[model samples]
Target: MTSQPTPFVIGIDGPSGSGKSSVSRAVATQLGAGYLDTGAMYRALTWWCCHTEIDLGNAAAITRAAVELPLDIGDDPSAPTVVVDGTDVAEAIRTSEVSSLVSTVATVPEVRVEMQRRQRELIEQIAARHGSCVAEGRDVTTVIAPDAQVRILLTASEEARLRRRSLEVHGATDEAAIDATRDQVVRRDRDDSTVSQFTEAADGVSVVDTSDLDFEGSVAAVMALVDAARRR
Candidate 1:
């Protein structure tokens, strides 16, 4: 029998509004691989805690919830889903409330440890099923999948990030919209950075700046990196 090619595990890390989700999905689709939104795992856990009335400030309680989260996130990049306890929260986890408080759940060291363990398991499962998988999140490149064949840090300017987040949350980039999104996108980044080093690319990781790139351009930039990595 012919030897099967080694599976590809692409790890992407970036801050909010850095085009990580879209770019990663596009790359996964183009490469015929599975896609994992690791950040959504954290957000889903946060939403579950909030929905169950778990206090966000209690580390032990939050860590316990993370350990027991009923998460069912899909790996299909074209039609990914997030189901918790039979409730689909794909859209719910993107709400302003979840975005604002997800950092609180994500910052708990125990919660991070539990989620990282879960993420590695998910990556292994996806790669086994699909021959390859592209996983993206704040710590995907550095922590969750540091040994991935292709590791990238997607970044953009804060001003650009705020504008993109404003458009996403409020459907407008006006001053009022940007102000409304500041707390979720900007403040959350501050809180999340305390636990993950996503601001810069680690040694041996590639960097892709999407500040001036449109959607297609950003996707292409990441795709180029993946192609180069595959050639090595």
Candidate 2:
């Protein structure tokens, strides 16, 4: 395979509100690379499931939806869009409906298997296109790209996460639902990362706690690590 101008990749795996998206994007900007938000890909697929009326509990149907889904990862590093089939779903995929169902759809072993496959393919393609990338998701460093050049595990307190969620989903969800959703998301993370075997980071992965740092601070922290690795 043809490699991009750079071969290095930094993977950031974290639970919600750990600020993986903001951190990864900023890290990519700092490194002059690309960024991939893996969670949005799953959410995009979940949104497609809703649009096509596929039952989340039906593994067979869901797997078929994932397989037949014409998902495209856009070429630009600035956007890195996910266009499903012919439609641009970069915005639609982040909906509360899709966010709530994303864990259920992503948890299905069949769906994870397929998405994992796509995930790896996309990483390689991104590396080919933009040289290096900082990919952020729950299972990215451990499961999707174990051999990545640099792996950063980001974590934060649930309270911080809820605060961030409140800002993001205030219009889409009520306060009670937001509270419940926060608990459910934490539960989903535990289930997928622990019970479902996506918890552990691969060897040489650095774990960072973002409980105190702001978004730019976290980006700076990861960039420091990436720069150090490049020197080695």
Candidate 3:
């Protein structure tokens, strides 16, 4: 008879467009675990702020929104959904407008605290329901889940990251598309780094560079790290 697989938390951190979202989802799917894209929480909050016309410049108001933010994030790796209040903002939050301003809401210290709190609660709840969970975001490995069983800092060269973001945001990888996406990807990294150290690996967290790895390769690499941790 086969033994039962151990339940664990896999914390993955990386800058935007480093394939953290895709890789984490694939890893969770392979392990039959739940997946949480913490970045989407920020993005959803940004969408809410915009929807309610709350001034993004008002740090206090943003924090208030974060505290009361009615977020319903699905845990299925195959059909991940993020619903805010009574509306589904999954696709809305990914818009260029939301992407450009999400860093603003995410940078507020109080907002971060509130969102991190929600993320931790969700992680525990998901892990309890599913066998395990793969939660990925800028601070997952450091702040969100420092004691996670498997912590990974996924990184890639600037050029590679730019190409991926260009394809994702604009559905193209041409020079013009990459140039257009540079501001969003580069500037967000600058702003997000102020609150979380995702560019570098924290203590006890492994680094996975996907500059040379394809999609399947990246997924396999993360899975390998998870497997190693499970054995230990």
Q: In terms of TM-score, which candidate is strongest?
A: 1
- For candidate 2, give the lDDT of residue 202: 58
Candidate 2 worst ten-residue window by lDDT: 193-202
Candidate 2 Cα errors over 4 Å, as ranges = 1-6, 75-77, 171-184, 194-202
The estimated TM-scores of all candidates read 0.98, 0.88, 0.97
lDDT on C-alpha atoms for all candidate structures: 0.93, 0.78, 0.93
Poorest stretch of ten by lDDT in candidate 1 = 180-189
Per-residue alpha-carbon lDDT of model 1 for 1-232, expressed as tens digits? 9997888999999899998998899999998999999999999999999999998879999999999998999999999999999999999999888988899899999999999999999999999889999999989998999999999999999999999989888899999999998898888889999999999999989999999999999998888888988999
Question: Once superposed on the true structure, which residue ranges of model 1 sit more than 4 Å away at CA?
Answer: none
Clashes of each: 0, 0, 0
- Per-residue lDDT of candidate 2, residues 1-232 (tens digit): 9953567788898788778887787778767776788888888889899999998889999999988888887635467788887898988887667776788888888888898898888888887777887788867887888889898888777776666666666644556756856754676676666424334445788978777888778878888888898998
Cα RMSD of predicted structure 1: 0.9
lDDT of 3 by residue, 81-142 (tens): 99999899999999999989999999999999999999999999899889799999979998
True-vs-predicted CA distance for residue 182, candidate 1, Å: 1.0
